[model samples]
Every structure is written in structure tokens, then in C-alpha cells.
Target: MTYKYQLIFLGDINNNACNTIKVRFFDKIHSIGLRDNMFEIIYNETFERKYSNKQPSFVFYFGNLNHSEKDIDILKVLLDNGDAILPIYFGDNFEAEVPKIIHVMNGRQYIADHIEKYINYAFESMRLLRENRKLFISYRRTDSSAVANQLFDAFVRNNYDVFLDTYSINPAKNFQEELHHRMTDCDVLIQLYTNDFKNSKWCNEEIISANQKQIGVVEIIWPDCTPDIHNLLCEPIQLTQKMFMNEDFHNGSCCITEECIENIVNAVESVRARNLAARQDNLVGEFVEEARKQGRQLIQEYRYLVETLKDDIIRLFIPAIGIPQSYDCFDSLRFRKLLDNEKIELFLIYDDLRIRKKWVEHLEWLNESLEVKTIKKKDFELWLKNN
Candidate 1:
């Protein structure tokens, strides 16, 4: 499968030349045994139509063997816009001295043999661009809206791709699904923590899901309120609430503020640098070894249970029902709207475990108390079976 990021190769080639180059490149790519889906190669002569559909971070130009100053200047322009060029020379018949800008590969075979090294460099550049390009903010509706908005504006002002709710995903049909998708896809998840946020089912779900997906979670904590740290799996960056309220919040020591947004940016950059360094140190190989050990441990522990569960379990869905005050929120009308009128088995959490009770006395009492037809778990299932 193609990754979230893609590679596009832009260079000058005639139809026959393009075919020959593609064949050579494809054979080299295959011989190196790299993943086929990781990169793409494109060649177009026209500058305007070069990358009309998708822009490439790395560009390799071939056939600039006899590099004139003009050719070097052109190569510099391509490199200036964050691209790498690999120039291929056919024969050493050049009387003119080659400029330092040209990377003189001996032949197609020489280029093919060292292709892996060039691609690795290209991939590293792509990774750095992805890591530094954007910041995504995730927040609950009830708490710290103003602060979140301010942070969003500040990040945008710094030319970061700020994906706050207003400018990010559109609130169309299946908006919740889109929200979850984006939450998982984002490089960072900025969480504004408050007591009300804990109470929100969607907010709690987002936080837990984001943590499980291994996205970076930065929590901006509220003053005078201790957040339930145990419930949050990721380590959160705790920023004082008073810091945000100050007009000089930017000047504070906290990294999230405007004046220190550079600090925050630098912190992320430092992390990227360190991570790259660790990868260079073969830390990823060590991690893989550790992961293999853990996998073996898991297989030993859950061998039978996993086999049994695989056979027995069909599907599972956990529906959320808010507190007694919002019992009406669980009415048939709302359930129908939420589930798109699909038939689903309903289970209610009773006594801290899921139960199949036909008629919940508490729900009936709630209907009587509020004079509304409160939808019990049994009622929902029965409605599903009948319809």
C-alpha cells in the first residue's frame, strides 16, 4: 500500500528515453529488494505540467552530463526548492569541465547499483518534511475554547499547517468518523483538559483512541483542577491555566505560548533530530528485536485464549449511554439517528458488567419521572428485531 506520503520524480525525457529509463529504474528497484509501494517515479519535460497532480520533495534529473553554467544554474533552482538531482553521463567525451553541481554517475549500471543510497536520502528528507510541516489540535467543546483558538492562530502565524477544527475537516455526514480518522492520522494531538472534558463521551473516546494509536498527546492542564492522569495513557505536557490568560502568555517559560512557540517548535525539531540519530545508531533494529521478544511472550500467555476468541467472537460494539439526567438522550429517536437505523444487538452496562435485561426498571422509572419514552437497551434490541 502507498504510504500517507508519496514520492514523485520529475525530469526531462522523451517517450523512448522515458521507457528505457523506467525499465532500468524498475529493474534496479527490484534488484535492491525495496518495497514497491514506497516510491513513485514520474518524468515530464514541461515545467508547468511536471507535478500538476502531486508535488515531489525530491527531483532527480538525468542527461545533464556536459554541465554548462546554465545547466548548473537550472540544477540549483531545482535544489533550492528542496529537491535532489542525480545527473547521468553516457560517455566521457565532454571537452568542457563539469561543474561541481553535477553528480557524475559512470553508467546506468553504476546508477542502478547505488540507487538504494539515493532513495534512502530522499526518504529521510520526506520524513523530516512530514514531521515539521503540521500541528493538529484536538479539543473538547466545554473547556478552553479561547485558548485553543489562540494557539491555532499562533501556529498558523508561524506558517505551520495548523489543522484546528474550523479550517480542518468539514462537518458533513459521518463527521464523527472523519474526526476519528483525522485524529489517528495527525502527527500531534493537542488536548485541552478540564473536568467537563472527562464527562464528554466523544472527548474521552478521542483521547483514549489517540493514545492507543501512538500519536503525540500534549495536554494543556487547567489550574485548580487535578486531571485523572491514570486514565490518560500518554504523558501530557502540563501548562498552567494562568499562563494562557496573561496578555504576555507568549513571554512565559511554558513552550505552548506564542513567544515560546519557537521553543515548542525547536523541541519537536530536537526530538526529530534525536530520533533520526537513534535510527542511525540502529535503535530501530534493537526495538524490533525487543518487539519480537514481547511477541513471543504474548503468544505464550494468550495462545489458547486467542485461538478460542478467534473462533467464538463475531463482532463487538460498545454504545455509550450518558448519565440519568440525559436518559432521554438514549431515546429510540436518537439511537436511530446515531446508528443510521441499522439493526444492532444492544447491551447495557448494569452492575459494572454488560447485561441482557429485557426491561430496565431504572429506564421505566426515568420515563415515568420525565414523561418521555426513554429507550431502554431491551427496547432498542426489540425494535431492531421487529423492524
Candidate 2:
């Protein structure tokens, strides 16, 4: 998962402070289960301006009174923008310089004694925020009951919130309705395919339902039989009951070995992640299409209003079109080329109010070279109101 927070480590490399923070702090953070690539270390002050448009979640600065004015300015800006600041002052001179608005925490002391606590707290917070685990176990009870039970028990032991019809469905409830409900909500379906799996009507229905909902399916092949690839929900993971037995596991066991369980867990998690990403991409595509439709409608409405205002002398500023996009994305580059050297105002209408520093750089280039106007949706509305 992509972390929403951006952690910045600003310090002097000459004194090896940055190295200590990287090795002693951030590495341990990742090892202790926080997401990787969630932060960056910046030793140079010149590049700090690159973050002027987007605020970081937290800033850690290790320096004394001799730190550059540029670094101080960056820290001040970060603190002012509601970001947390951890300042490590080598001497007493800079202690008084820390802003009152930001809670001043000694970075060196925290790294030495309380880094693990802080890191673990952060990890727990992130886990709670991203807790969306819905697993469905699809198995042919008549053929693979033993292995299926073992897999289900293993997953429960690992604290996963999963759905197994044997465990999840109540005797009083309508079985088919409850089963469909569980399958619809599942993020990933783990299919335990035995020799007679395809012959089972219920198993085929489950697979078809999962496929129709666009949920991910992970097949655990217990039999020598291969499922028809064209009809299968997703790629099948071939695993035999003998493979588990080869590792000193027996038929009577209630659960599989830890290694086997870990492998299954990793596979399920990987497919679950893919399912989430695919859904998000589909949502973004849908949003872009709807935005384009609305933007064109608004343009047509405004154009008609302009024509009505000036009957014969209606001199529109060329025939520029506005595109709904993020500041960094200019997918209409070829379309823009079609209006080359036109007097019309080419407005890049952004989706949101917040703009990134990288986007500001892109916009600056567009303004100087292409003469395109970069405006937010709110600003465009304001222009329409005033005009």
C-alpha cells in the first residue's frame, strides 16, 4: 500500500548524523512492519524548495546553530503547515530557535531510547487505518475436507478475518443466500480444488460469482486435475496434499506446517493487494470520464451564453478547450499540439485545490513554453462568476 504520510529527514551528512538516522531509525521502522519507501532523507537545502507546494507529514532536523538559513526556512514552513517537527540540536544555541507552535522533541534522545515505541505506535496506527481484510475459502467439502479444514484453522490462528462456510454459516440461515453474501464481500477467494471440484455445482457457482464481482481468486490445487483455465476466476496456485505430507505433515493433523501456512498467506495477500489496486484504477478511469463529460457540458453552456451576450460581435479568444486533470498529468499533449500557436487560453483545470511542488514546476514550464494556464476547478468557477 502507498503510505499517505511523507516523512522527511533533514540533517548534515558531514557529521554522519543522517547515516545514523537512516541505519538506526528508519531501517528498524521498516523491519518492525511499517511500510517501506514512506520517507526520504534530504541533506541538501537547495532541494527543499521542491516540497514547497505539498506539506510533509513530519520533519526531523538534526543540526546546531550553524545550520543554513535555507534549512531553517524549510523547517519553519513545515512547522507552520501543521506538520510535526523533531529537532536535534547538538548545542544549546538552536534550542531557543525552535517554534512554540510545534512541540519540540529531542530527536537524538528519541532515537536512542524511544524510537522502537514510536515506530511501533506508528505501525499500529497505519494498520488500523488500512484494515480491510475479507478472505473467502472456496473448497470442495466432499473431496478436500481435511486439507480445507487445516487451511481454515491455520488462517484463523494467524488472526485473519476469513469466511469458511463450515465455520461462518449458521444452521438457521439460508445457506445459499449467506454464501453469496460472504463471497460478494470477500476481497480474495482461496479455492481448494480437488479431483471432483469442477463436478460440484456449488463450487462452480462460487467461482462464477467471485469472477462476476471482480474479486481475486487464488486456487490451491490438491488434486492432479487441472481446472479449465478459460473458466477459472484467476490463475490457479498448484499445491498438492502430498507436498504437505512430504514435509513430515500427516493426514490426521489439524493444521499445516508454519512454512506452508506462510506461503499460502503470502499468496492470498498478494492477490488481495492486486484486487484493491485494480478496483482503484477502475474508479480513477470512471472519474476521469465523468469529469470530461461534465467539463464539456459546462464549456458548451458557457459558449452559448457568450454567443447570446454579443450577437454579431462575439469574438471568442480562439477555440481553446479545458481538460479535467491533475497538475502533473498532461495526457492531452497531442491534443494540445493541435491548437499550436493559437491565441486561445488553454486552461488545465485541476480536480482539487491542493497542488504539488512537482506540479508547480510542470505548470511553470507550461506557462513559459506552451502558454497554457493552470487553474483549479474552484478558480474556474470563480472566473465564471465574475465574467
Candidate 3:
């Protein structure tokens, strides 16, 4: 009953994307070990009845330009209260259609299968998802460079922080060391499994490293190529000759059809969420084990860890997979109110490896003003021992 969140659907409820989002969103919640009751879905409910309070929400505003004055007013209130609202519109004249208050810099266009992109944005807004949408593309230049470049453009358009060695690595950095470091921070490894993918030294090493880290793999199997039977973490999408727009795929003109590109991108998004959840699970397990050793009793409450103490005091720990942001602090403080305990403490636990020096300094500065503190991954053992 603590820290329950809401997903509110506003404006153009009839949008096909709305219904599609609900089904997929539920799946995403389940993948992350959260129950349906932890997240309430609000649709067709009056703002006064359900959302009049200041609880944070993720709102999906659709393409319908025309909206009632009442709903518009409600949206304004939500914005003032710092609720997360996402507008989905494909048409021009976005400014003219929606009111200035509801207008965003840009809204995503609706694609049923590609709703993962929007969901990703929505979760980040709610601080349940990581701020960095990092992905690593593993493919051979000679075998699948063309298709890889096309997918890179497509993912970049969707706002993913993609790491392709040719584009992501800096000339000043060490090649092998940087490559391994880049792979460490990624949520998913999208490998273009060409005939020679396993044959390359770097490509094979990349796969080995990814599996050792237990990262999720989205395998795009090449045409006429057979995938390895091992690796339960690997989600394979076989490419037929028809999926390629270019007639000669063997000669390295691997331009995939638009539909094919969309499918692979969607697959990556789906796998990305699952991979993140798995990583979070590992973090939670490690923390729980350490807490037990320190004679601290920790219980699972929804997606967070809760430690109950005497005199109705409670400590809530939320797992932050990638970089922790300001929204994480704000959202955790908001949820602290929902618990019955008057004396409550909140913390965001995140991995500290490879985080930039400036970002860590910013987090240090940020913690001074906020009641919610962050615990770095490296300090888990010492924190457990002392606290």
C-alpha cells in the first residue's frame, strides 16, 4: 500500500496507440516484478475523481487536436504539479492544435509495435526507468555495415544512446579498454549475427563479455545463417532475403526494408526493458544479502526495498539502474507521503562504475538540497556494515 503510482490516459482516448500501450505497459510492469495493484491505470475517469491530488502521474496525451476545456485545465494543473505528460502527434501545426500550456517541444509519433519508444520516455519521466537509454550495436563492418548504419540512424532518431565502435569510441581513448567499458554500461547488446560474426576476434569477445555480465542479447540473424543453439538470454529475429531492400545482401548491401528495421528496433526496446529489470534484480539480491549479514531486516514492498524500525520509522530504498536523476529524488519524496510511517527515509541505490566525475559531483551537490540520498554500488558493503 506504499508508494503506488498512476498511469493516466488523457485526450483522444480513441487513439489506437492508447489501447496498444495499455497491453504492452502491463507486460512491462510484470517483467520488472511489480504487481498490477502497485500501478493504477486511469482511463475515462474524471480528473476530480481520480487525479485531483498531487500524486505524480505519467500522462499520455494523444493526437486529437480538439480537447475539452475541462481536460485542458486538468492537464495544466498536472503540469504545474510536475506530472509527466507525453504528447503523441504526427501532424504538423502541433502548436496550433494544442494549447500552449500542454505543448511540448516535440511529441512522438504513434506506431503500435514501436510503442516501446514512447513507453521508455514515459517511464523515464516517472523515474522508474533510467535516464540514459544506452544500447550497444555489435556487428561486423564488412558483413552488415549498411544495415547497421541504417538501424543506428533509426535508433538515434528514437533518442537511444547507441555505442557503435566506429561512431562511439573517441580517437583519444584506448580502443580495447574503451570498447569493453562501453559494453559494460549498455542495457542491451544488439548483435548482427552475420556468417563471420563469431569468427571476428572483437565480435566474439564482445559476445563473451555480454554473456558474462548477464546482459540481454537481441540477435538479428543474417539471411541463411544458423544461430548458435546456446544462450537462453539471446532473443533471435531471423532475417529472410525478403526483409532486405537491397537485392544483393551477400555483397554487403544490407539495406533492410522499413518494416524489417521497425521490427528489429522494437525487439531491442522490448529486450532492453527486460535486461534492465534483470540487472535491477541482481542489485536487489546483492543488497538484501548484505543487509541480512548486517542483521538488518529488509522486506520487498512493490519495486522498492523497505526496512521497518521501532516507533513507526521506515526506510525505503529504490533501485536506480543507470544514472540517478533529479526526478528520482522528487518522485521518491512524493511517494514517501503514501506510507503510514511518519518518520520515513528514502534512498536511491545505483551503480557507480564508469559514471563521469562531473555527474558524481553533481549528485553530491544535489543530495545537499534533497532529503533523499543516493547510495553508490561500490559502497553497498560498507553502508550495510555501518548502517
C-alpha lDDT of residue 295 in model 3: 87
Clashes of each: 0, 0, 0
TM-score of each: 0.37, 0.46, 0.56
lDDT of 3 at 367: 81
Query: How do all the candidates rank in terms of TM-score, highest first?
Result: 3, 2, 1
| Model 2, span 251-319: residue lDDT tens | 334234567666777666556545643433332233334444445212111101111132322212111
Q: What is the lDDT of candidate 3?
A: 0.70
Window of ten residues with lowest summed lDDT in model 2: 299-308
lDDT of 1 at 100: 51
Maximum-TM-score candidate = 3
How would you encode candidate 1's per-residue C-alpha lDDT over 74-122 as one tens digit per residue?
A: 4555433423344433345422333455432211222445555545444
Error of 3 at 171 (Å): 1.0
Better of 1 and 3 by lDDT: 3
lDDT string for model 3 (1-387, tens) is: 122456888777875678889888888867754447546577656666665333335777775556522267767666544445676764665665555665532456666667897776667644454236778888888888988889888877655778898898889987777777677778778888888886668766767777766566888988878876553458889888888875557856668899998777777766665565456556666887788788887754334677877886788888876567778788888656654445988988987665556667788788899999888877899987777
Q: What lDDT does each candidate get?
A: 0.41, 0.49, 0.70
Q: After aligning candidate 3 to the native by TM-score, how far in Å is the CA of 377 from where it should be?
A: 4.8
Q: Which ten residues in a row have the lowest lDDT in candidate 1?
A: 298-307
Q: List the residue pairs that clash in candidate 1.
A: none
Off by over 4 Å in 1: 1-126, 130-132, 157-159, 247-257, 260-387
For candidate 1, what is the lDDT?
0.41
How high a TM-score does candidate 2 get? 0.46
